[model samples]
Target chain A: MDNFDKIAVIGGGSWATAIVKMLCENNSTIGWYMRSIYAVEHIKRNKHNPNYLSSAELHPEQLDLSNDINEIVGKYDVLIFAVPSAFLNSELEKLNESLENKVIFSAIKGIVPETGLIVGEHFHQLYNISYENIGVIAGPCHAEEVAMERLSYLTIACQDEKKAKALSKKIKGRYIKTKVSDDIFGTEYSAMLKNIYAIAAGIAHGLGYGDNFQSVLMSNAIREMKRYIKKVHRMKRNINNSAYLGDLLVTGYSVFSRNRMFGNMIGKGYTVKSAMLEMNMVAEGYYATKSAYKINQENGAKTPIIDAVYEVLYEKKEAKDVFEKLTNMLD
Target chain B: MDNFDKIAVIGGGSWATAIVKMLCENNSTIGWYMRSIYAVEHIKRNKHNPNYLSSAELHPEQLDLSNDINEIVGKYDVLIFAVPSAFLNSELEKLNESLENKVIFSAIKGIVPETGLIVGEHFHQLYNISYENIGVIAGPCHAEEVAMERLSYLTIACQDEKKAKALSKKIKGRYIKTKVSDDIFGTEYSAMLKNIYAIAAGIAHGLGYGDNFQSVLMSNAIREMKRYIKKVHRMKRNINNSAYLGDLLVTGYSVFSRNRMFGNMIGKGYTVKSAMLEMNMVAEGYYATKSAYKINQENGAKTPIIDAVYEVLYEKKEAKDVFEKLTNMLD
Candidate 1:
């Protein structure tokens, strides 16, 4: 096994903290870079990420923590980006060092708002990273569950099977399991698409639809996801696989999903602006829905769920009326 | 359309009551028969099923209720059997009337214990009913949801598309939507198989697995169901359809599911016998697991979920130990 030694995690979100926690189990000196100097200092002093995943005890001795983006990017053999898709551009703008040789894996689950490209495609198109050197960390695994040491599954996808397998070994632990897939585009797109579906689920739930309807909505959502992904990246893959349907189920059904929370408020008659304000953060799916709707204009897939979500979020339609129209479209 | 008039519901359970309620929206003088004479009299007097779905009002003026099975079977053109699989044989034993001419549709979600066949197959093999005459009503629906008048979806499947469509029209109402399918065997098998998976889900929850694990288990289950159904009956069908995956989700995730409740108790360290004793009722999945395990032995589909449930429920294996082994089998 060709072990790529210095692996660094970028971003300071809950997912980043969680990924670093997983890497800590296998790697001795894991590199962690965040934009926040205070978070870096806090972790070094308090032994945990105070802003996110606070309950997860971190080993400061095992970490090579820094806020300098260029230093970590230059030193690391593999860089795993966990930043929100909306802010990924600004974080990369601070980087003066080349990413040509550094293997990149994204834990982000949305299209980059600036370019309307998935993180892997963004790196490939702009940063000139080869597809083999780029990878994706897709999750049915939630960061909160990881913090609780609960059993969770992650999919490591890279065109190169060897690199995917190597990364899988680094993340697998007593409570975490990893599967490797060559369908990087499919996995990444499914991960981004599921959040939009989760918002649809939350809106239906908030509109007084019961569990029976929710189950039907989810069944339809997975099929819609399969159709949409196949249009973007044609692949021979099972849509029922844990990476695709499993990821959708966890986000759509989980009470802890922020996208669902945002959608719930929208369904309860709050405008998109009000819902975002109430959440105090923008959901990844909000950007994903807009980008996906635009992409589907060229790559046509019958995406009723996505259309309903987009109409409610960006078009500023009433969630109740949009969802009412949606019920007829689903099986 | 070939309309089959004089539709009758044969059972006194909650499902039978819900079906009768759906029928009442389109049909007048719906035939209803049960072995319980007191319950039949109570419904006639109270205008509702006193024992089940008590909240759903029944119009006595439109119903032809009887305790005599022959009277209802002899008069009705279409019979929807909603009896428990265990009691189905006994229910048929009470009828001296021939069912060869009647179009039979089953709402039962288990295999016949005596025949080790799904309800549709059981009726076909033993009762000499033609495949075209036999049908299935599969659901992502709950009887409780119907009682509450919540929107729910149903799949009406028959080899005869006309029969399926006609029956779908009879059942479709303000709160219920129906889809027609021609895969009677697959839908009926999926209905029975979903119970076993629900038990697997319950055992996992009982043994301390979280939502992440449950999502993966369900995703794996739908794939396993697709593989298993294909082996038994070779057909072209989307396993992600509401009839398959939607039904599984409703049964697996519902709080009202007795199978889950039973499995939860077993996971909490209650013995199978003790769990049954405490509930004072046997879960349909308990019988389903045994039958499905036997069927799979011949079919040769890899079913770790069903096997694990069987070991815990029938083979007297510990829940923790079996689930520990199961975790490794799932992705």
Candidate 2:
């Protein structure tokens, strides 16, 4: 129906910038809300995000960059929240009133700290919006690839099939392909859970485990993901789906994966603090591990991989010791 | 119920050797039938298969190797058909009389060359046995890894869940984990279809398409796989399960996969003949493409990936041209 005239993207991160660039290709005006004046000024001045996607240039003409959250949210019909999970709540609180009629979509993939609610749920609660008004762009997709004009696919998950389809039509293109799914909770949960497994995969790699072990860890992670997602959401998730298993495999093993790289460093005897500091990027898995561990404990869900990751990251267990513990759990 | 004692593995391939080795680990004598005197002599003398798994050292004390099919089949209680798809019928024909009351499992993955029947279906017709007697091992696994004693998982499919579980317990070990599924045809079809997609993935890689496009191809391949499997078998297969989608993803993308590696060579400017000659191994996709194309034509199923792979392999279409055609087809 071409309902969304202007798409509002929140955050100046790699993923948000990539989405805004893709949406701009459709000849639609994009409102990008960045809290940092430096990010907004850089996009306005250099017409590109030098920090994350330095190679691909962004067109400043197509973008309406703003530091004021209210000004940005008020300009678009569809609002895309691409901020980190930790910042989602505060960002939504700033746009609470403006979010009423707009179709809000969360591109963030993590559970709210301590609350264990998904980003979409957090948005719905703070904004006082119906679930139908909320959609999640969950996937086996990365913004870095999209910036390179690489083809990627994502699942547009919403309980309302009509809204999901509508959003799918808006974002679907050559560089980005979108599939419609009814299981919003399952999709969001999968996106969140995979980060935890990616960290675990890194830890395994760091422990001198080879590709064979990494593949096995991924296989087990998918099973554990299915179990945890099913227990919490009461929805049937295909552990094999692109959003769940596919994402896990790629992120768990790919050289481009920061979480895996971070984990590998930890596996190679780097302290968690040093690894994170050296990465100079937040490996979502670091935060996701603690969040997922808490959720698993509260829900009484059995997630051996998540437990192992939490132990390695927080409980001060050695990466090799964690690998030995996980290997023993396999039989 | 530990139903069988002596296990007959009917093939001299990597998978057959690996299964024989696993059975040997449990202190069970394995009868392996091989048609080649060279292979038989090699297995007998060096106690290793230099063809499929060069790294694995076979223990001669635990295995009985023979070129005589009758001698191998008559003595064993459980028979595993690990021969190539092209050889399954003739091999089964030789062991038909001995197949009665024996647990016959297919480690092969492809439809029959001319008949277009799944190996299990051919066995059902040849021996006049119920489908219950036929078992198909579908996987997110590889023989090379299994031979290396790497942990792997597989799905044992049959119409009878009780029999499936019983068989699973018999074959499963610390390294080889097995699960049971009632959707025998769907699982079988998915296993064969994955080889075709692996070829497509290889072609994509050869075309210099990045991981983004390859991931999309894989995602699309899973969708196409689910559609074709469901259309032909009419069973409710969880497309996201490890048996279906998981197997496809691993085999389609992994460096350890022969089919993918073979396809990769073709994608990287090697001819099919050259790729085959270079590897000095059978790329199951090369054979599977023809059979799957024939089956789709006969069953009125839509398998664009299979059709495209068939066209590229048999029609002699340039790898880049096939990729261009596939991308356009998606549009």
Candidate 3:
């Protein structure tokens, strides 16, 4: 028997919907815990998420939609936490009793603000879970692309090799590709840093900078990622690998990137607050920049790009002035 | 005293113009060798390159535009060969009598067609020039962007550590950034392979593929590059480094990329011959694909991407069918 016959996905975002849709291909029953009762009812009745994944049709039989977190949490052997970084702690707290002995996977891609901990790290500490039971889905995959069934690749990272390989096999399919790596910290750090760079890329685009400038920013961003990943993980990671630089390049340049789009709006002369209000959707980079800036300062890691982004987004510095400073800073 | 004061750029193309302009900033007198007397007169009289770099103004007083290969070869202590890869041998033969004791630096980035020899390797064999006296400039730097004063980086590869460091200092300026590496073959190969992939990226865009598919192609191209680089050089290269994958990503996705533009035309149902006829300039990738394809076959290197490109370009394979085959080939 496979280790996981029943998988529970917690969240109602586009990414959560894509994961559920992908998992259903495994021919296993899926439990989806949505915080909004209306969203759950809508998904149950329509067999589709109208707000996020409107194009992807979910089979009604394969989905177990609920607002009661306990019912879904207790029923599954594998638990996938797909909530945003800010809400992960509250959601984990609600499911703490039911998480015992289940394999927990985190699809959240940011560091928690107050504690400055990655989602998996937080789960490990609060739930007394071994590293073996924790896996992180760090991606070159995007929710928008997943809906189109375009080919995408992801890294499933865990400290325990056996657990990592097992999770890799579980998610590998026609449209979705999975690779296993032992450097959970490296994978997680890359995922977070990419969001920060995407914001910087967006700001450049908003500033009316052409493709020339955008390409330069992305190249430098990846270099910064390499330096930070080395500092934090102290592991041998191929910075050139798809999981690291490849993911950063795609997200930084893509039109559908929310963080880049947010930065672009701010660069086009909107205040950070105004941009956020306009976007309606949360730009993860806004939060990620804060967390990364603090972490870099505390850890003595050098990240000029992230610092410049923080200055623009939080310190109310002019985007053009910050960009000029960034260009001049390069030797 | 510096070993070289006056440098001759033996090709009046965009790359040569950009290199000459950069060298001029270092207080070095540049002799720009052009085969066309009309081009020489146009550059000298109007302070502009009529054919290649029309947008950027060149100061006539700073440049000695000439058709006399002997005069250029005799006056300069260092020669920067910026000729097209196909014409390198013929150009060198023309200047052989005047080439003595002068260091040679190749800016061309391709292998010889029939011999499968890198440009630097050909120089070593034909001129009996020691590897210590030969250097290569390869990286993410584009001629058009360099002329526009955009920030760009290059790897200066030479077997002699002292010569490499000295040359790096000579060219390091505001727009041109330099790094030193010993892997000449790897650097040259990276430069060549990136063009091939840029064509592939262009084809993807031409076929109306979104960023999702393009990212997947670029990511896989980098992986193929890493594998091939290791196989050829037997040295470890960081694909995430600015020299390898960085250059590839910039060229593959940028709008200013000529190779990608050419590939896009072909992918949009234009015949390869028709695309070439329509283009105002030569796309180096079209030539590189032929050279690399031949080399890969001879060396038994697995490069499905290059093969697919060759098939599409020369064998009259349909773009849609080729792409379907490529995706099917991937796991």
Candidate 4:
């Protein structure tokens, strides 16, 4: 608790609420921040998140709540950012406090739009945060499951081995299991890429492809992921690790994945804008497809799944035609 | 088509019938054997299988139907065994002719119970057949989907490269795509191993594990598979190949997979005997698990999935308790 005592979670989504719930199991007190003063007041009075994970109660005495980003950033030694990447830039814009020494953990699973880099890379280049101080929280674990207290596993990745193990202990509990790893680049990229694959899975499902096809699609997708990440980072780690393959499987197969949901709507013949309007939350894969497509153009990895999703979501190509072509490309 | 002209399918199940159906599309004449005299008559009279994939029509003129194993084996240059592995030995016992010169292709996905060998191995060891003459048909393709004429892919694996390619062309059609591989050992073992994993997937689903857990289970299952296969038969094969990973995914996730269905029942509190009584056919994984569990005792691969499933199915351990322990073993 000595090292973990001053941790804070940013953003007000379901994942942020879930992260707070996990941290509270080990540490008695921590900080939380949200932009909405009204939501802050609502949680303080009601003892639960008003919008997400409402069943997970928070102790008012344990939580240091604030509307100003700088107030929480100034106080906490460790910052866990859980905001959607699309909005991450604006949140960091309000941070007057320097994060050079503070350890930062990212729970966000997208590339920052302006930089087209993962949250950790964005912070390292833009905020002058060292990679050694950057950490990532990855999962096959879903927030709804954590709220239900079902068994879940999390991978805490950092360039600093000691920091990773220390953070892993703070998050592990009765239903939550944690593993520590030093491959932060692989974990973060896998997290980002899985969302795109999930969108691919959802699109296939929406187009009425059975579970048989879904499984084959996933098999090919993981292989493609191995190829893509190898070209980008070229690490010695197994992609089958929970941080990579397990995370990909969950996002691709789980009903909780919003990227899959967005892809499903597109496969069902909704235009991208209509699908986004229907779902109030942002789907990171929609933004990720563009960034990944641009990145792959330079790197030149053979990614049929990503290309199909990009064609459907960005180029306004027919989902049926793209997926039909995709089926031939796979297996 | 000319080389595959003397080909015969040596089983009466849905998969055997599907094979015969695919072969007939390319060859002008093919042989089929069903041990059931009743099923043979039913097919001849009704133009389809009486018990399995009943919708797939067969022309009596195109098929050389027989019940005697010796007649089929003696006349056919290539013998494709599609019978359930549990009954394969007794069926083979009826054959008086040797398989020394015949090309043996195994579509069966279980170890011969008495011999404790796969169908190809059983033929190679007992009938003095060569590995060069042994072949395996691997699939993410389900027979029911084939009956529905859905597009599907198959991998024909043989030690002899030319034989593998020749068989691939015979099976390739408008609805089916075929790829040839020379890794006969890797493909056959993976084909057998996938059924066991499918049962594990089913058991988890039956015990109320969600897709997140299933994906994790499957991801771990694949790695475990890679580990186990490497121990028994070291090779340069990618487990992600359609023959390995694709086949495993379909069996583990597909609704049509009897192995998964058998596992689901076990997880849903049915005893082994009760689950077997409820289902009419053999679940190959039930037998594969026992054989694999025995083999791994010497191989010493750390297979928590196989061990947990064996405990639940054979050792009579409680599914809930076994799976709870399995959660700790996974990530």
Candidate 5:
């Protein structure tokens, strides 16, 4: 618990800012690392994140901000990684400091693109961090909701109960509730897989399905997620828990979800490239679908939803045709 | 299967009309009984129900319509009851025709107020209908969605597989998909219980909780539902199925759900009486919560969601204070 007191959040996204906001409530000073020097100076001059979660006021006095990743990593005992999965490799390459001794927790919700490993496994396998030192932070939460001080729930999963408990205490606040789990693999895999399902939800919505079908799709999605997760890491975890199903619901049903928005465009007949170009961002699900589909090929889980989305995005099958087939597959 | 071929829909509500619409797709002649002679005449002339789902065009040429309950019951081999649970006893009071030979399927999703049992159980215990002859028609399919010809799924649950399959065939259409289940008790109980959870959802939204909390509440609700159903009817069933979780989602999330709307009003500070008076209809959950609460006292399932809604609606507990306590109860 003492080692976890000097926690540093890595990345400058909305989710990272939100985590910092939560940590600021419980800590006298928190380590924050971002690549952009201007953003670091902007936060020092102005007590708010300029790029993301702009309305969330930061306590600069309580923040030990740095543009250099190694400096922050060297100073903090616990490093919470929150960068996008696609950029995780490059971010880690910049870190000369050892994560071998630190209690590492991933606030990242994706599989590292190069390795097809979740951030926790990526850290454990590549960086030699023990499973005991690795943990995951998950949510049925949105960063925007945190900015508004709306009530939200987070699940912290670690093999070490004490480490998970310590992190939970730091993150929980008046509007934030926390629970601990030992299922790191299931929670992280679910966190990554939900983006893909959100895309499926978007496609269904874009293809003109109503609330009735959306409900059914979600019901099936959770079951499919359970099946998929079981293949990767067989555990006795309840898939209906808030960390899995609750997170899926918030992402799939949320209008603010970029993954769902990307899917909506696909369902509305936008090519994958066009949808990404128009949005000026790559949806995390686009990459996740490819990775999960490939991973399922080895595990051999019967995943019709993932298969359909893969066909539409990777195989260039028409969204109409793919979802038309998906309709017969769900119930 | 042959005995269930001659079907009569017994109600004048939107749900009854929706069932008739599905039946008309496969049957050349279907019997319909309504208490309102005016509604029967209106449908006969206008090809749509006058009071509900007016947009659905009925096929009068294939319809055998009457106001007399006995006339329809005497002629048809299968009777599907879709009336409000509160009015069911009065409607059944008029049925002098024996139900001993008939196959009964309930589309009504509430407990019988007088008997405090699910409609399927009420028929089995009181009307002397064999469990094999009783069935339940459940939805993640809303009546409104059926009217729009939006693709939806229905679960037909009967102890007798052939009867369930036959009913599924009669109702399945281009936009309608059907599956059969043998767990009649579980399905009926879930059908009744979802409304109570929907009411709970409305109260949360009414009290200004955001989507993050709603998702967590639903995740907890399904888990609570699985636990509650197991106590009453111990069987091998996945509570995440379309008939259970999917139906719960449609009701809890749909803007069209009267129970949710009723809960929203209560959340917004309307007393139950005022909310009922304003809507000009009773929210079925108001009564269902009472029945379920009393029943749970015997079973003693640890159902926090149902308990909270029951307190708010029946015990006159303040929605704000009750929900504040309820939030801590959910994950």
Candidate 6:
């Protein structure tokens, strides 16, 4: 706590608010940076983020809230970014202050849209941050469940096992459990790939596929995920770990996943533009599908599920037909 | 179709009816053995099983329905057994016809209660049937879904790959897809173990755990399953195959699973006797938990979920307290 006490959280999403809620159990003061001053003002006045997880109360005395990214960056040594990957670059663009010395953790379970690199790699290559300084937070946890105070587990991954363990200590609480890992890349990639699979799950459900097919799809999916991640980053990590398989299962099966909801609409015959307009949230997998489809073209894992999802979501193929082909490919 | 064409299906349950439905597509005549002449007469008249899968239409012209087990066994060269494992020994006791020359397939997903051996092993060791003659039918396929004709996958596992492929051909049809594997032991154990896990999944859900915990539980369950099966069988089977993981997923998540429903009732504070009394069907996991718990005690695999379920259902531990302890053991 002595060296890593000054922790700052970025983004104004439900997940970010949930993280702040968890950190507040141990940290007396947390630096919070949000681009929207209106959301910040609402939280300051209401003692909760009015937009997300409104039930989670906050003590203003424990928060160092600011709109300025550089101001927050200059103030904290440990910075946790929780923004959507699509908006990550824009937020970092506002940071004129150097991240060379700050210990960075990504609670963002995605690749940066601008660079098609995971948050850790993006920070290392573009911001010149050391690999040891970057860490990841992977969860089978949902922000809504965390707001409800349901028990959830998280895996903290970093090249520096000490940094991962140090941050994991602050996040463990009555309702939260944590594990530490050195396989940062594996955890991060698994987090990203799961969103794509969840979309496939939603599409299958909307297409009237039953639990029997869904399970086969999931079982095949974990294998596909293992193949893809291992191809990209060869590590001695178990794909069955909660960080990989658990995240995939929760996201794919949860009713709360926006990616699945988006895919459900697509399966229900909503076009790409209409589905996006209907839901006020980003699906993440929509962009991820394109990036991963392209990425896997090089890695060349036998990714039938990802290909089927890409064909349906992006290539304007019929969901029914695509999935019909997928069924034959699955078992 | 050479020597295995005269097929007999033994059992009158939904799954048996489903397998019959699949076989009827290829076999113009199938030897059907049921203990109840009433149900046979009912199917003959109604063109569907009166007790289960009542929606699945049957062609009595294609079925050689019989009340006597030996009569059907004597006529068929290949036998598919779908009886509940608890009733298996008694059913086999009625068979005077030798099964030594017949290629036997087990659709039973529980162990033989008397000998505590899986159906395949019991036939191999006790009945003088060669391991080469014993096969397993595993599924992420549910009969309810099969009745609805939704696409489902089945895995046929046998020591002889040729027999597995031959049976897979009979089972594969317009709606059903099949995979063949030489993993009779792995598939059989996986089929038995998944029921126990499904009950655990149900108990967790009934105890108010959310999707987050469910996924973590599933991820952990699969790893535990791999450990347990690998220890007992010591086979080179991929735990991610449709036969193992897919079957577990469907059983755990499907609303049609009686095991999950039974566990749900128990978790909701019903006494085991009361829960059993309420359901008309057999929840196979209830018996499976006891068998698997004892099996693992000797195998020495770390089976926390199986142990927790056994304590809650068999030892009468409170679901809440048991699950609280289970949460700490997971992830």
Candidate with top lDDT is 5
Per-residue error (Å), model 5, residue B311: 1.0
For model 6, the stretches where C-alpha displacement exceeds 4 angstroms are B280-282
DockQ versus reference, model 3: 0.35
The Cα local distance difference test for each model comes to 0.93, 0.77, 0.80, 0.87, 0.93, 0.90
Ranking by lDDT: 5, 1, 6, 4, 3, 2
Candidate 4 residues B14-121, lDDT tens each? 899999999988999889988988998888888999999999988878888988888888899998999988999899888888776788899988899998887788
The runs of at least 3 residues in candidate 3 whose Cα sits more than 4 Å from the true structure, single-residue gaps closed, are A93-97, A160-170, A204-217, A265-271, A314-331, B165-170, B204-210, B235-237, B265-282, B296-304, B310-331
Q: Of models 4 and 5, which has the larger DockQ?
A: 5
Candidate 6 chain B, run of 10 with poorest lDDT:
B1-10
Q: Per-residue lDDT for A1-331 in model 2, tens only?
A: 2376777899878888887887787755688888988877887889788676766688888888898989988777788889888777677667544666788888988877746678877767756778887888876777777877766777888888888887787787877777788887888888888888777777776666655456556656777888888877896655566776656665765777877888888989999999989988778777888877777786887688888888888999887777776776642
- Local distance difference test, candidate 3: 0.80
The per-candidate TM-score of the B chain, in the order shown, comes to: 0.98, 0.90, 0.93, 0.96, 0.99, 0.97
The DockQ for candidate 6, computed on C-alphas, is 0.84
What DockQ does each candidate score versus the true complex, computed on alpha carbons? 0.87, 0.23, 0.35, 0.55, 0.87, 0.84
lDDT of 1 by residue, A17-62 (tens): 9999999999998999998899999999999998999999999999
How close is every model to the real structure, measured as TM-score? 0.98, 0.85, 0.89, 0.95, 0.99, 0.98
| iRMS, all models | 0.6, 3.7, 3.0, 1.7, 0.6, 0.8
**Fnat, 2 decimals, each candidate:** 0.86, 0.16, 0.26, 0.42, 0.85, 0.85
Weakest 10 consecutive residues, lDDT, candidate 1 chain A? A1-10
- In candidate 1, which residue ranges exceed 4 Å CA deviation? A1-3, B1-3
The candidates, ranked best first by TM-score, are 5, 1, 6, 4, 3, 2
Q: Over the stretch A29-145, how does candidate 4's per-residue lDDT look in tens digits?
A: 879999989889988899899988999887777788888999999999899999989999999988788786899999999999988999999999888888889999999878888
**Count of residue pairs whose backbone atoms collide, per candidate:** 0, 2, 1, 0, 0, 0
TM-score of 1: 0.98
